[model samples]
Target: MEAVHEGEIVDVHALIMSFPASNTGFVVPLPSENQECFLSGLKLLFKQAGGIPLSIRIDNLTPAVKKVRGSEGEAQLTDEFMAFKNHYGFKVQVCNPRSGHEKGNVERKVGYVRYNFFSVPPVIKDFDDLTEQLYQKFLIDRKRMHYRKEAIIEDLWACEQKQLLKLPDNDYSVFKQTTIKFNKYNEFKLDQHLIHVPKAKNYSQLYCITFWNEFKVITNEGEVLLSDARPYMRKRRLIPWKDILKDWVYKPRVVGHSRYREYLPARVREYLLTPSLSLRKQRINEIITLLVQYDMKGINEQFYELISKNDEVVSNPYDVEWSQYDALQPIGGENHEGNH
Candidate 1:
């Protein structure tokens, strides 16, 4: 499926689950088709159904199936997927290679969902909000009569829910943990995205724990260093500007060559590029302190307004009083107090 994500038209991974006997269907759109997304979608499905299915028939998806054996369809499941299945205690039936007919119902439901629900691409500002909206739509859809059962789909699904296995005491944690080394810029490449780790030493190895939509970088001693929303697209970079301001203050010259320099507001960038080293450091230090109480956007707006009033730089950009200008006006109205 395609969605407008953060102002860009991007492909979303749509996982469709169907209960053939009841014609009950569920769909979850994900940012990517990685293993975490695959397993997390199943977890959400189980939650929505209020119980786990006894057996799940799956296609040869890369996240679940490492390889399909002979014509009989014996398969080697990925270790993470195998662990998830064991945790849930469900049987996995892998469909034969190129055999869409085996899971024909679900394959058809995929198209059904695409046309009925996502015919028009949705604007996804928040992924969780989008998922909740889709869940509500599915509930409304279940109120209709089944295609062939002559019963309400929701009622049939209610009966099927009673036969499902009781949910586990706890949900499975879906994450992939690996060790990665940070580059000279204190950033590590994950899924082709560069994620900056604040205060991390260059060339240091850290534990990277990847979830469906986010990841965390931790030290060997289990201290969490950074957590950020993971980007699905390649060549994207995530930087925590506020957290790194202290480090950057010492290396003011590097700001000019930074990849993120272009993203800064022109006025703020120009302020940072001042020729006086002492002034640049002082202003950035003030910004770092101001960030604790106000966001960069607010600070930038205030700074821009202050600098715009005068051609020269304001010594204290953040602490200017516009009311002072009104104090300089005449005590009485201009027409009554004096001649023009």
Candidate 2:
């Protein structure tokens, strides 16, 4: 694990895997150490290697092993880990207790990966991007000749790849799927963070699949209704303000008394509370239309600045040049074409 030396001390855990025979290695960085992280790392390794190893050897980590009986005794593996092993058709071999020496190849890979990739303490903004780039860097190591065998690592891996087991046809989700009934507020709280469900299905039970960094709420029919990209180490509610405002456009009067009213921009709140209901509805509709091309905060901030400074409101809010407000919002992964 390495601490991301930015403002926050975010710890990024690297799951390192190496094939001793081929002298090939794979590393997958995750948010933290957990069952989900383990599963995601293994999935990434399988995708990169193009097949599953005959057997995976690792230290007795709690995520994989529930209990390590003894050198001669059977190792008790976690149910989830066992399921993963069964799906991939790989045998799980746990090193002896306190026997880091037993996994020498993987142990040496820790320093090799660190010195080559993590030594500079990668200046990265997105965890996914950092992991993806580092994986590509790892591929360069394959060009080097093996220390003992004196053969290129890439060529050896190519031969070893054919001997490995093929992946199962089924799609393996690295997250745990569960169901949750939406409360009266049309929302559900996971890990003390409240998330809004779709207004149409307020009271309906949805299938919630929780991942390491995010969660998804799907319909009973398997359609994804919402994808909540949760921020790490933050305990704040994530309400889809755009969705709520869209619904509020039909009933502008509710904008004043709704629980989420305070979250609206000051200018927008004033406009909605205007005594002229027709004008309020018109502006609300305009806001809903603006939501498609711009972020709510950017639109709200720019709108407030214009009305407050100029002492005049645009006759048609949508007609206003929105390009200036575009930069007010941060474009997060909007143009990301890189594959995960």
Query: Each candidate's lDDT (Cα)?
Result: 0.74, 0.71
User: Each prediction's TM-score against the native?
Assistant: 0.66, 0.59
lDDT minimum window of 10 residues, candidate 2: 331-340
lDDT of 1 by residue, 1-340 (tens): 7654322355667888999989888888788889999999999988888888899999999999999967665789999999999999999999888999999999999989889877766655456656886889889999999988889999999998888998899868999999887777887798887788777874256899999988888877888878777877422223355766677689877777764454444345556777777777776776677677665555555755544554244555534343552355322213221101
Candidate 2 ranges beyond 4 A from true positions = 1-10, 178-208, 217-227, 231-340
Write down the TM-score for model 2: 0.59
Poorly placed runs, candidate 1 (over 4 Å): 5-10, 71-73, 202-204, 233-340
Q: lDDT (0-100) at residue 268 of candidate 2?
A: 53
Error of 1 at 23 (Å): 0.6
Top TM-score hit: 1
Clash pairs, candidate 2, are: none
Query: How far off is residue 15 in model 2, in Å?
Result: 1.1
